[model samples]
Target: MKRIVPLFFWLFAGSVAAQSPNKSSWAPSDNSTIVRIHRVEQVKLEMPFPDGSSFKNLKLDEVMAAYHIPGLSIAIISNYKIIFSKGYGVVTPGSSRPVTPTTLFQAASVSKPITAMASMALVDKHVLMLDEDVNHFLTTWKVPSNTFTEQHPVTLRELISHRAGVNVHGFAGYNRNQSLPTLIQILDGVKPANNPPIRVTAVPGEQESYSGGGIVIEQLLLTDVTHKPFSAIMDDLVLHKLGMINSTFTQPLASQWRSKAASGTNSNGKAVPNQWFVYPEQGPAGLWTTATDLARFAIGLARACNGTPRAILSQPLAKAMVTPFNDGGAQCFHLDPINKGLFSHNGQNEGFESLLVMNWKTGNGLVLLANSDNGEYLWDILLQGVSKEFGWNYHFDQKPKEWLLMAQIVGVDAMLKYFNTQKATGLSENEAGEGDLNQMGYFYLSDGEVSKALSIFKDMVQLYPTSANAYDSLGEAYMAAGEMGAAKESYSKSLALNPQNDNAREKILQLERK
Candidate 1:
């Protein structure tokens, strides 16, 4: 991985580690496109789908009401500084408690990136070794020796990268009245912990797999090594250093902070019994933070990547943290390739949802928190709006729904003819990509529009004749359309193209038996 040089070292660079930007000064600048767009409540932006329709101006208030989100908080960072921070709606469904800029929400899996950052700090201080076998450092309950471990002992690096083959993709938090399990009990999947035991399911360093269970191991390692609580260690190592004063990894947040905490709500806007789900799995899904605080953490990381003096991680370690460990998986942060040097992660625990993104190169980022399970429905709109307002190079795409509208307007046959002609003329801007078209076909199938789906899959197979997946999808579409002979033919072609296509092989067997 390449080291990120400080931003000020470049030709156009002016200064480094200067004072944070003034938000009031950013108001409606007449000369700036970003300023003009920022003034609007919502801005229309293009989605990823080539054939998808662009959404018109969407209002935040309308979206919140439509989605039943009780509250939302947002912060935008520009040029290694916070440019804007605001809150919307209420802390609870029927409460008069308006969510303020300081109100905290559950950070959920966003906690993983923070945990990884703290671990990197440990690496810098020689307190933790990334490539060292984690079992050697763990003083608490040990990971059981299994067949997988005999071949390859799991390392801290692999654990953070999610290539350790750890089981348990995520955790669903316990209800307010439910008995909370100890960290060991959670790892062992005994009693109160709802999920199965965290164990290696494949050879370490095999492939990319998301595992919250792996992060929990890091949490344990941090506590055991430091002889202090995870929250306290993080505070000293990363949180306090980054000036994220409104954030903490403490599970079951203390009573004094309750008034500033946003209550979680379901899709229908009903509040959770205890206002929020309790996440004892601290490394993966336990952090209470405001968007402003998270933005501070992001800015600190950007400054660190740029080699600013007094920054948290050194340039080498920061680069490695964002570097993809196995395949395309970043150690903890999720990589967004659309924009250059982007690292992001999203989180969901019960009714609360959160996302944090930062473009390290540009020192631009955004943080969003919503107190509703259905908040995801508004993510695209909200992100695109912010991107447009700030002129950030973020890509937000949707599955092509223009095909459905086109089928309604020019008829499916006409659309098919147009798509089929792409063989010689080449794919146009409006033509669907393999994944997008495949998903669109499946959406139609799920919606019981069998004829429309068959048309789509037929086009897909025609366009991508050698694709095993395309044929498999076509076969599924055929089966749904009740054309068993056609389905069998498609499946056979799929199996021939890729013998490892278990889905096609199974479908063929079922058809043969019938």
Candidate 2:
């Protein structure tokens, strides 16, 4: 949360005039300029209008400015082609550079799908097999023998589908001036690598745990098997073949393309430290691309599924790639059942974010990229807008109703007072849980509003007195506020309520020692 904009106020701002300087030169893709322009104003979240209407028309500039998002690029595809492509907001605050359809953004975890696609190229050539043990292909560093992996070897299929039970959820990436590690160093979690060692934590094929670490191993496998650089291989196998001409998997980005890059921004509407993060782990989180370019990739894949000659994959292989290993996990790409067979993927870097979605049958899709931490939330809103305009029959998640309603009718403070008086009458565990207030407290804590956080935590404990989590959260607020005595008291209460709360017990010991 930024001090300049309150969360509730920013989320529910009234319509402001379109402030986008780039709006005047609107350039939608060929054949659908008018419809696409209208779609921009149809921006509505899942929530109904204040007066109970189904949707509300919102201006792109107003929403972007409200959320402090510096830049956004969007592309809509239909019938195996891009129907619209446009940009909103500036590349950086107070800069003359405006975001364009071609503005490159860090693709983040969305790189996984592209990497998977390239790996499929190897499979097609009979150089690799999906079901074979990945360790057999590794030449530099191998997956260490462990109790969990002894039962079943980690396979390429399991790794790509996130069923390999590997560790390391993602990478925070290294800053520009920091020493960069080799691929082997990152896998071994040796010096200069920020994340822990990539290792099997659970029985392979038993469960799915998303691991960028697993993807890194696949990256290493591709390089070892092909005897080629990861970026060069991906460019040849996927990017060039799919006509993703403006995309690259190169780390730190090339110097010639630097001028076309969008500057990364933090949640506070400020530039990220050192501008952007350098991702050496290319398989999971390294890509520089535009929304339009991603749209082309999506369209090409959808066309391939329909047995189009331009598809990089055969019809059967394309179908298998999008199919889930189990009901819970997508193999190479994510599938959304509610959106009528949409294959979707979203990614987030330190300050950049992107989303790609396409219905293989309809050949309709959306690609969105933004240069801010808040881009994730903004993308949800944009999805709702596109769904409504195109009649895509997709569902959008609703905003927190009770919180919004209470915040509007009664003040934010009134909800706390009402909770204190009403007990379980108005609030349900699902609606206004201790976790909700706990998260709100941390939001303020991250913004350096310790007093506000303290008040929120107090209200949480007052409402959910029996919950150990509530008292534990209150103790953390007290500790953050530098009130050692109160923190100790809250921790003691938490420990008394739940002896399983080792965290609270340790905190009490730490406070007494201090």
Candidate 3:
């Protein structure tokens, strides 16, 4: 069974690391056109998440079971209310704590929006000027030196928006228990500083730089401006006002909170719990929350967006805060189109993944947090349930089964087990005899499973005796497999199915020459 599926090869490839060899046939769904028309219509409703229904098909319990997530939390915000917030599974899998709505999970990057809210509040109070150089209030940290470009002092807006133009990038180092360095030391590549972290290395305001250190620099300004630690500021400003009693800025496991720490599995597939409080990088990353509390935050933003009553960040600034910026990554969660936009953010540590989605219009939003690395699978499923229920545009194509089947084939070593066990490579002479086998053949073909593509095409020809496209794709698959003779015959058969087949005719001539 020479399966010819080229696996995705990338080092620390960002989420959606889809470079798989068997992942060539994704004709982005008809959803793209629908998305444009909706944008044109700009449907205004009290709530649009699941349209006429609630996103409740795959319950939290089911998703947790599938992903091995000890705990999971989700909140959907619309109409300025706690419209949907729930928790499922276990806090520790073996422990007795059934995850509750208030269970505190390590709110990874979700912390940034909290920080953004705090900063925007400061902006409203005139204590934090968005356009002013952050250096004015900051005395403890200074930008690192680099010859790549001149350092134009970064502003408060640039830091929060991830537009500082220098990505200090990932921090596989710096965890709990070790004496953490000052934010300045982290940026300067000083002692105990595990990774060099990304040096300012680029001119400020030139591009987006996703630096946790940049957020730390912003945190330091909290002290410089307010004469208090970030923890206190969060307690006084965000927690108290929002009434997020179960959530805090400290480590998830240590707080007097519940045992629902967000978690993820390591390379060995062992579940690892996550909550880092070694250093408080408020602007970039550092904050813990529960789905319930997070839903409140999302609700507040949505209310503020729709001119509904709320107090998170005032309508305009909260509107501005959701605006997108470069994060040393691709364009995603874009809230403000070419003009004003909103953004999406994710948090990931050893055992957990967290996502927060905010929309600039109608102020609708949603967040899903998981206690396992595969928690994203739950997110995908929930998004589907939401889309099917509400008809709202969350932008996830409903082809998850197809995508996951492909992902499983590409991501796992079980390919030979499943692919090699199939029956005859072509149709069984009976009409209803081989339905499941044919579906599997089609699955393999759509996913770039080269040998399977060939087999499926052969089956289609035998079963239908009149599928031009099927035969054409079969020819292309053989051509890809370096079998010119087989490809030529397949192409010729496809052209015979329809005399107007220019593409198949051309391919047939090309194969003949070959």
Q: TM per model?
A: 0.72, 0.84, 0.63
Residue 247 local lDDT, model 2:
91
lDDT, residue 299, candidate 2: 81
Index of the highest-TM-score prediction: 2
**In candidate 1, what are the lDDT values of residues 1-514, reduced to their tens digit?**
0011111110100000011111232343445645543453452333322356533343555446545677888787888888777777788887766777788899888888889888888899898898877888998878778898888888888888888989998898988788999989889999989989998898888887889999988889989999998889888888888888888888788777787898898745678788888999999899999998999888888888888888889988888877765466666677765676888877778888787888889988888788876555455555666676777866654422233333433456765664455435775544445654675476457547788878888888777889999899889888888899999999999999999989899999999998
What C-alpha lDDT values do all the predictions have? 0.74, 0.75, 0.55
Most accurate candidate by lDDT: 2
TM-score between candidate 2 and the true structure: 0.84
Model 2 Cα lDDT, one tens digit per residue, 345-375: 8877888877888889888888878888767
lDDT of 2 at 457: 84
Instruction: List RMSD in Å for every model shown.
Output: 9.1, 5.3, 14.5
For candidate 1, the lDDT comes to 0.74
Candidate 3 has its poorest 10 consecutive residues by lDDT at: 6-15
Clashing pairs for model 1 are 48-397
Cα displacement (Å) at residue 302, model 1: 1.3
